[model samples]
Target: MIVAGFACLGPLVILGEYSASMLTNQWPPTLPLAVLAVIQAALLTLLHRPLTAIMETRPAQAIVFFLGSRLMSVYLWHVPAIVLLTGVQLLWWPMPDPGTGAWWLSRPIFVVAVLLVVWAISTVTKRWESPQPILSPRWPSDAVTVIAVALFVFQSLAISSYGLDLPLAVLGLVCTAIAVVLTGGSSNVRAPDVPSSTAEAMPPSPR
Candidate 1:
């Protein structure tokens, strides 16, 4: 039943993105918004329990453990990695039209190249994508992280709006790197001072 609901609403919301009337009517969020939320919640319900159990089991444990630290890296770099891929495409296929013979011939290679590039970048930068705990509870690290994320967001918006600008792209990348360094994402970095235990989920603590 939930799956059916999602299947029905998902298509309409996807198609509605092209509808100017829908945009105007729901400047912030329209029917599509509700539809998408319903779909997401439904899907999460279906997957959450099974995924949690699998992640905890013996077979999947090792893979899950490896991915745990790199989650942020994957999220943070995927967009810019894709943008970088566009530049890379130019080198191999000067004429990148979809219908062109060159494009057809090179499609598989391009896909593989993109996957490899994203993977390489994620591995190299994973350490720096997050801040580590400091000796004395360095407080300023939080603000630096926020600013770094802002820079990344700005770069993503700029790239999406007017295509890639190399200077801005580099600036965003540098900002994240600096943020990581400031947060102690290096050999000097230490894990956050908090105990490495999973406490039961609870409401915000007064302390």
Candidate 2:
């Protein structure tokens, strides 16, 4: 299955690139992309066990945990980091024409700069991603959870549709705050226990 999945994935990727290049006013070639998605899902199903096994190693677990802890911060800040880096480059260096050799050559440096900036931002912002221990006796009710989720989804869609103006930004913030407050208090939740030997083997996560 894994071999078959790789065989399928190679051709699917090539087809996807071809389909992407042929794109016109249409944002995506829906039919081809949909077919690609279905094939990718099948490939995942075939490859999941092996992938899971590989990710279960100590080194993989460390890498996963490190990134997972700051996942949200990375996602939120990466675009801003890219924008900042582009601004810096524009100010300090000659702006290369798009698709030119100079532009292509500078991409690796831009990528590295963006990553570094995002990493620095994540170190501070990651605290927000961590869940604080909730001491409240009562957990969120199902109705409350549903309402919070609905508000979050609605606000997200509104922001996406209208773009992030002050009103939509405020609405998104309010929805996010409400969702956090609604979901905040749960008692008796604890981290999974690791064996002492495994715990000893694991490297300390940087603050």
Candidate 3:
């Protein structure tokens, strides 16, 4: 959104001097905002850990609760909600171009309307997508989980910000290499007990 705002501002402010054609064009001051948003999201997610532990420390339950929250459910239903709300809005106050004029570009009313529509749709979808029961222990080992999560975050960000270009492909390969190394190292570390029938049989000879 910050990037989009910059794109719009460029056209108006500098007489459309900034490059807006290419996908890799400068997004002006969006990097700071993006970084801040990422940091805030990480902090907020971490903040939930203590609260979640206080409520229930079970890993499965915690994972379900985290993913099954209203925020996530709402995102799943946002598209359908947008369709419905657009239909209703068109019927009532028909907008030819929602983002045409100066005020229209950043209309809080329109934003609120879309949010309301999403919330309503989310409420309905949440009924169907209720949190599933905690079955088996689904979490991977810590190292594996961390690598998987990092890869996922990077891939998701790349996909959203830029297409699957050379840079993203390189990033994906690097992540894969790191993950493989970590996993290999973890697997090389053996447990203390070495299983053997001879050792088990001769264990109580002196005792």
lDDT of candidate 3 vs native?
0.61
Q: Which stretches of candidate 2 lie over 4 Å from their true place?
A: 1-36, 137-147, 161-171, 178-207
lDDT by residue for model 1 (1-207), tens: 576666766576667653444334344456666666787887888899999988788879887767776777777677677678887666765656766887888778767776777779878988786667644553444566676567667765655555446786687678667765755453343335454354344356667
lDDT of each: 0.66, 0.76, 0.61
Q: Which regions of candidate 3 deviate over 4 angstroms? A: 1-69, 83-109, 127-136, 142-147, 163-207
RMSD of 2: 10.2
- Give candidate 1 regions above 4 Å deviation: 9-15, 19-34, 94-112, 129-133, 140-207
Instruction: Write down the lDDT that model 2 would get.
Output: 0.76
Question: What's model 2's lDDT at 102?
Answer: 90
The local lDDT score (0 to 100) that residue 182 gets in candidate 2 is 75
- Candidate 1 Cα lDDT to native: 0.66
TM-score of 3: 0.36
Candidate 2 weakest lDDT stretch, 10 residues = 19-28
Model 2, span 44-141: residue lDDT tens: 88889999999989999999999999999988999789878888888997889987999999899888888999999998999999988855345566
Task: Give TM per candidate.
Answer: 0.53, 0.61, 0.36
Q: Sort the candidates on TM-score, descending order.
A: 2, 1, 3
Ranking by lDDT: 2, 1, 3
Tell me how far the alpha carbon of residue 96 in candidate 3 is from the true structure, in angstroms, after superposition. Answer: 4.1
